[model samples]
Target chain A: MIQMNPSMRAAGWLLTFAVVVAGAVPWFLWGSSQLIGGLPLWLWWHIGWMIVATAIFAAFTRHGWDRYLGGIDA
Target chain B: MPNPALLSGGLSTAATSVELLVVVGYLLVALLVGLVAYRLTGTDAEDYYLASRSIGTLVLLFTTFATLLSAFTFFAGPNLAYRQGPEWILVMGTMDGILFAILWYLIGYKQWLIGQQHGYVTLPEMLGDRFGSTRLRGLVAGVSLFWLFPYVMLQQMGAGEALVGLTDGAVPYWGGAALITVFMILYVGLAGMRGVAWTDTIQGLFMLGVIWIAVAWVLSAVGGPAVAAAGLDANNPTFLALGSSFYTPQYIISTAVVIAFGVTMFPQINQRFFVAESAAVLKRSFALWPVLVLLLFVPAFLLGTWAAGLGISVPEGANVLPVLLGEYTPGWFAALVIAGAMAAMMSSSDSMLLSGSSYFTRDLYRPFVEPAVTADREGWLARGGVVAFATGTFLTSLTRPGTLIQVGSTAFGGFAQLTLPVMVALYWPNTTRRGMLAGIGGSQLLYLSHVFVPTVPVDIGGTTISLFARTYGGWDVALAGMALGAALTIGVSWVTTAGVDEAAERFAVGAD
Candidate 1:
């Protein structure tokens, strides 16, 4: 029953997908010495998704995700 | 003679005095803030325990963030990075930041709504009222306390190590532990929630500033980030890679899962759910949580990872931060970093102490021992409990059972085992008391067996009762227990149906 704006919901799912794909998989498969910002590529991959996750949450919070979904009575 | 282990290469008497003065000054400021908070808050239990549910966005955000960091992140995190390599950052830094943010939104938003409607302060209080079971409240509190004590001791032990490391054995470990314990008791007992949050905000800023400065200084001093990477690659090529021996796929995933579950179930953190001024405040905090985490963690971990490549010897892993600061930085800078680390410990310590007191006073004492106790009496009892718990942790710190990371992990594992029941109870309407109880109890039994008696075989009538001695590749005992708890809850809830309609109405997930 927890609802968000359709676009926001889609964004949330997209972010989750990104986190799962970028954060979890590459770190295990190709955790090589390829450097990104002085960190391993896989590490940067995870950090990249972390930033994306932050952005998604920021959108959710900003767009009144709970209110959009009718969870906030006020 | 001074202890060789505590002696830093560059520490002088003057540096020691400066470091001590900085640490002491920080503690004094904390006490003053506590006194000021005492004057600001009302004499009632709600005001003292929950800050009257009137916390703004920034204080709530920083308090939660600061409390979450604790001595573990400040001390053990760098040590792990130093010992294991840079992949360790993936375990705690990236994973925890992401996971905890999700949890804060999912759990915290709902809990804040529930508390606002029902006037609840503690998680157990909310759970008990939802289930209409006093025993359930006691059980949750008891479980939390069991895990929380070691965590409290971890902070004290970290403070002790930091002092001893910075002072070069001029201050004994026990002396450091005792000083922190006393200060935490006095401040927490005096200030309540208002004081704790105020101090947390200030301490959080101090920790943030000092870590950024220290990291920049260290990176610049030991050449640029690229140069540091080259040094590490030259000496230990795998340090810059993932799936290294220490960071196998299974190990990294399992550690992340365990830490995530454990961290979300921390009593003090869970209590923060009730103190947010609004749902928006909670949301804003979560929104910024990862950024804050990344800001602090990257530099600290980088410093540690680079230390190994720089050939800076870290004899004791948990002492890495202090030793790095003491030997490499100027006297005042080293002192400032030490004070910041101490701030991290103290900010967390007071919150934990306050939560522990609430658990004891509200959950245990009032229900079982003094059902008719007045609010004024309850406040006094909570303060008294703070003193008692701090003293207990101080005594435990004397043993130096393990490094900050080791002790912290054990506590984290224990708390993680509780997450399943908590989550299910919050969202699932079908979760009966039996199912809930079984979930928590069974998982704990399985977890304890795995951690303490994984291979203990007991023969009764020629039948051995040691079914808990199983191991899985890459799965930490805590994650396994959480999985088992989830299974038990879902399985038991399916066949049975017995919960109050009130519970159903109150806990309808996403049903505002």
Candidate 2:
């Protein structure tokens, strides 16, 4: 199996946790009319989370996900 | 896109000509890309099916994104947003990107690894081998084919509507559908995965660029996003807020789960896992997928939502893109945007056709019908399969079963129900073949009953007895079907894990 360093594995799980918690929970943007950058507060919140999700995934891949990717285990 | 009603003030003769020219020109360019890919890859089965597993980072990323962002994004997304409000964006735009991205990482990464090891070309091949059951492989392929036929038909309908909208009814619906069907068959038949990806890249770029331009133009023309919000606030106040009364919280979350799971099992996308050059290439693509998708979806939905503020009245059940653009913008801009929408439809159609062909050739035909067939003959069969499948879907599309969005959801639901079995097969090593079989079989049985049969009945001596009738309620039937499927999968796997030591070992890692 492709191996990852301990810290990188932790980071990967951490990002996944964040994505699950914030991505699916609608309460994070509940009933807010506030607008940021000419968009609804809820819309901005979702968009902002998307950016964070991308950055976290990008970091995970760069740090250790790449190590686990190249070879087939068999 | 739905069936478009003709515009009252039709385009000028010059505009009509230009519009047709732009779409035809785009189709020609796609054909050229296919020819180039054919020259690069030849007609070998391996090269055609998997691009010889040599796709680069950029091509992989765009091809995946472009194929996923089908006519649903270009047409249904905005149309829904225009009708309901920004909440539609929440459902498809913001949520789908994140959810699908996570799935891409969780499922795609491992599939890529195993695919490289085992030379798996289809999802069923992998699953079948994992359980040491040819029946499992055939069933998986069968389920995918069943759902995919309608999905292909949906794209055909989308293309036809896009053309009709662009030309103001001058180009008949069937004419547009036939044009795309022929082009799709030719390109996919010629170059295989390489051709599809290359053309998808070009179409992907076109889809991205043209939508952003349309959004910018519309935003400027309609006095910006803030002004649009303000107008909605004045005229229709509830639209500017979070939860709508119509889109219940249960509906939102359930649909989100359904869509997220559904997308992961798409046969074309599953095949994409096998085509990644490296794990890193796949990682980069997944990491960047949400952002690329957001770039297209956010603008497209907003423009559709904002069109209302500009006083553009779209015909009920018609695509808003053409109506809004035709009324407000010049003919050239309208033509360009319409062509871009067509790109979205064609890009998706080609990939679906290609995947369907592979499933038939590798998963069903070689194993079931013609085991002694040569590799060259299999390649020819794959091409023939594409033509036959496209023709079937085209005939189905002519019937126009439902609106684009409705048919899309049905297709999505069908695919989504299979996600449970896929995940269990992938991750749960102790999952028995019986469990996998039960999961797939039970889910489909329940789903088909729910969707197709109105009630369960029995007949004895010419007297009919209704045993169970479905009740109309708040719960989405699709969500219920998926839940039942997943529950059966998990429950069966837990109870039936004793006898599959060898299968478990195989599933745990790769074949030794």
Candidate 3:
């Protein structure tokens, strides 16, 4: 079983928090009506950010799974 | 969000008949799935309630996916996107997608462990046992059922409205709702979690396929993606931009937080925490969750936004999806998509009824009404409860008390009130039973006051203050309730002893 250390846990959570905040609303693209690939830039940002969020979640689950379940052998 | 009234003129008789046939066929498939699941289901509570704890990756993922994306996703999401802007995607897709996945780990993984250890079936059961309070257990169950009632009705209401829109009022609203209600009672009564999960997997896949098809076809009819984007840009530029009147930072965050946390407490969803066959299954499901969410939400919300670009004019209180599809897609194709919408509603409703029955039996009835009930009798009572609860929610749907978003959001807030206390009880060994009750009871009261009571404005000096405002400083009632719940839980526990009990000690031991 892979046990994530405290610092590693903190870093994982902090990185997730950062990604969530960044994707919550595209602050940088706020009020910008520019189009990207026919969709709004902000909408595209969300699409791109969702991909990023999915990657981050996949990584967290891979690395931090034991932190929560803690070697529970189901 | 699609009003039956606007659905009156679009479909021909043949189209209406085809759509009705497709919907009826879908319901039949659901019943058949239930029959198979019933045959496979064991006589014990564990098998009926949690599928014998043997569900694998695909079924678990899709069941959770289908259960969460209900009529709200099918109707309200698009309606909001069409009316407001694409920012609705931020709430449903981006923020909620990520937040709920994280919560699925933080809350669900822990619950999975405890449930495995204790043979727990419901959230309240776990919490009540951990705190050694029957009253607290009942309170949590009561809160969950209370909120679940509205959400279940929301699905029925969506069904009625969607059907009325598809058949152009050939199916009356009551008839549409009755169709789903009767079918749900039959299937959910016949098959428990196993049936619901299997059917949910089908429904989830069907919904995903139908939405993507609808989007692809509509984009083609409306001159493709670039044309649709240009049309939206020319017609409703505000939709393309951020900082609209409705999609404020506060609004987005608060809505996302409420839904993400509140979903964890939903009787239907909470019960799912215990259904995974293995830790690896749970891990895979949560990891894939965000991707699945985006796959559906983007198309659903984007379709609504594109309707604005295509110059689709929707009346107030009506959904844009059916209108958009009716305009751009073939009759058979439109009918097929409406069937997909029905699939979404049924998937959600069946799961809700199944889990609500478990909560009623395991958490409420078994403990409070029948202490020595046999396992077989308990299963029968749960099935009966499914019928009664579905019938009750169906009748409530006939009254049409609120819009999909209105009732759904309120229920989300109500469930959000339970999150903090449950978290504390799960992780904190010093959490007292009294504190649990106070936290849940008080926070619920606070949240309900905001939901039920009309706001009153009072003049204080020169500034006006609105009492019971739903949102304060951008944070909504759900967040407010959670803060108070957490505060009271921690504060009350600090001053009170946990007593000499094994409940708290059980969780304090190192995880296996």
Candidate 4:
């Protein structure tokens, strides 16, 4: 019901996918250092994932989605 | 005579007496603001808890910024940085700021916008609307209470320790503790949200100004942050860097993930989304928060570096800021630094006390017990809740804290675990209430087990991990808990009744 421009929706979903995949990469690939720029690489990885999380969650806020999805009268 | 360290650092009788004045002064100022601000805040429940939704951009911005800058940055950042090295500034603090911006400016700001349109009042209210379940609302409220109490205690301890150091025994632990507690309880109790916001604005400004001065003093004394870091790293390379490449990859990646996503989920922050007058204001507020957060803690890190260079012992951990302030500068300037640290402590304490009260009065009390309760009565309850919660927090702080900062991180991580399912279900109508419960319960179980068990070691494996485990060495507990919770919520939510909040989800998830 919540519609994004094909671009934003696609981008949003893509970012979400990236977050999931990046998070899971640990199951397969591991970094050599606990510190990346002074932190553990996993934490560094989470920082990257957080960006994806925020963007995807924020998509829920875009007004056009509510309107395009027919949730609002307007 | 005081211990050599104390004596060498100018922790004398006269100086200590003056410190007491600053401690008492902070409480007096808070009470004055509470008494004066009460009139402006109105007597209704809305005014008391939500300021009748009239908080301005300037005040709201500062309060929001202030609340997010917890002991993590104010004291922990520099303490850890100094103890470890400058890499944390780049790794931990930078990551923290980045993650914070994503949540506050991105996720949090947008939520504020959406809330304005939907008339969302509380976190559970928002979740309840999305899932259409009274039970979920109650569950989240319960989660908030379980974790919030310990956090409130940590803040009180932070404030109390700073007070103790400043007073140098002229004021007992309880004296400084009682002062801030009474101030927070009275201000939030009497003036409600408006008063808290106003004081937070003042408190925020005071803290920032003080931090800048403190940083300058430290830099002036030690030549600067770069020099300070270089000074320490020259001596101990192992403590400053990842000891081996073994844990490096997993540590950085996991910490970054946890901090970034885990931060915005703090309930105190969730409450802010509902309080915003508009999304635009909230966004602007968040935009400023990153730098503010950076500045607040960077100096502490640099100070830690400076302290280690001087071979200073950061006793009680919470006293890291004051001990540095008192010793690093002249008497007059040290008092100012002391004042600023007080401001930082109070800004956070006041906000949490108010937020905890909101949880009790809004999320827990009014909804489950009496849906028909008047707004005024509900507000009165919140005010009283502030006093009650503050008392509990004070009592908890009396015992010495081993890892004050870690306690905060663990509690915050537990809350972040809830963010996924709760936020997702708002848009994805197919997310079942059962999924929410299952995910949250599973995650919490894992976390509690860690609390009871010892899955990871502290101080040895990772400093950040140590920061979360407190004494138990359970940083892994939180990480595992969050990861499990997120996965289970989605996996479980998908299998159960497709919780499609057709109207809300249609806009949220685009899966309708």
User: Please, what are the lDDT tens digits per residue for candidate 2 over residues B1-512?
Assistant: 11112221344576687677777776777788888888888566667878999999999988888788787778877887777777776677444677777777668877887777778788998988888778888999999999998888888888888778777777778878888898888877777789889888887887788788887887788778888788777766777678777666765766677777888888988888889897778878877866776777878888887776666787644588888888768887887777767766787888888888888888898789998999878878888888889999999999988888888877888888898778767777677777878888988887767667767677979987553332234455667667777777778878875454335554444321
Q: What is the CAPRI rating of model 3's predicted complex?
A: medium
Candidate 2 vs candidate 3: which has greater DockQ? 3
Considering summed lDDT, which 10 consecutive residues are worst modelled in model 1 chain B? B1-10
RMSD of each: 4.7, 5.4, 3.8, 7.4
Which candidate has the highest TM-score of all? 3
lDDT of 1 by residue, B134-227 (tens): 8878988998998899999999998888888887777888888887898888888889889999988888887888888888888778777888
DockQ of each: 0.40, 0.37, 0.50, 0.09
What lDDT does each candidate get? 0.79, 0.76, 0.83, 0.61
Q: Is candidate 2 or candidate 4 better by DockQ?
A: 2
lDDT of 3 by residue, B1-512 (tens): 23223333344566676667777776787789889989988878888889988989999999988898788888988988888888888888754678888888778888888888788888888887887778888999888999999999998888888876766667788888888888887878888889889988988888898899998898877777889888887888777887787888888888988988999999889999998999899988877877788889989999999998888987544467877888888877887787777776887888888888888988899899989999879878888888888889999889989788888999999999999998888888788988888899889999999988999998989998888999877678789899999999988988988755537855652343
Off by over 4 Å in 2: A1-28, A63-74, B1-12, B455-473, B497-502, B510-512
Whichever of 1 and 2 has more DockQ, that candidate is 1
lDDT agreement of model 4 with the native = 0.61
- Which docking class does model 2 fall in? acceptable
Top DockQ hit: 3
